[model samples]
Target: MREVPIRENSIRLGQLLKLADVVQNGSDVKELLASGEVLVNSEVELRRGRQLVRGDRVRVGVEELLVS
Candidate 1:
């Protein structure tokens, strides 16, 4: 289990991508997100602008990221 802290309760989808190391650049977040490779709470997430809050778990490949 890995944890990433959001400076504010409101974090953008692109920000979460970089924090999760799914993409090296924030600019590529949208592409990665559109690939339907990102999962939130075990469900496929396709929205790059999706809002995330605490207790949301994002999973990519074998990585499980916990937000709090």
Candidate 2:
């Protein structure tokens, strides 16, 4: 997994996805979520507004990102 740093204590899942370069845009994130390809920790996450704090893990396809 790769680390993606955030200035704030928490970040929205959609914003994190973009920051990590996991998706191209908000639309892409929506589609990806609908497809059930986005995971928080180990379970599927469909909420774009899901709050993520330090040490949270996000996985999409073959890419895994760690919030730091």
Candidate 3:
């Protein structure tokens, strides 16, 4: 598990993916997200625009990232 700091109130899921270095770009995120490989707080999340705030947990493959 790793902590990814957010400097604002919240960030969109796709943006977070990029910020966290989970994906290379928006297109990568879209394809990855569409493949149902992303999880938010342990649940599958398919929306790129999903709002994520501090304390939220995101999992991509074996990587677990916590919003801080």
lDDT tens per residue, model 1, 5-51: 98897776678878777689966877777778889888999887788
Instruction: Report the error of model 2 at residue 54, Å.
Output: 0.4
What tens digits encode model 3's per-residue C-alpha lDDT throughout 1-68? Answer: 99999999999999999998988899999899999889999999999999999999999999999999
Q: What is the C-alpha lDDT profile of model 2 across 2-68, one tens digit per residue? A: 9999999999999999998888999998999999998999999999999999999999989999999
Please list the C-alpha lDDT of all candidates, in the order they appear.
0.82, 0.95, 0.94
lDDT of 3 at 24: 89
CA deviation > 4 Å runs, candidate 3 = none
TM-score of 1: 0.83
Ordering by lDDT: 2, 3, 1
Error of 1 at 23 (Å): 1.1
Q: Return whichever of 1 and 3 wins on TM-score.
A: 3
Cα-lDDT of candidate 2: 0.95
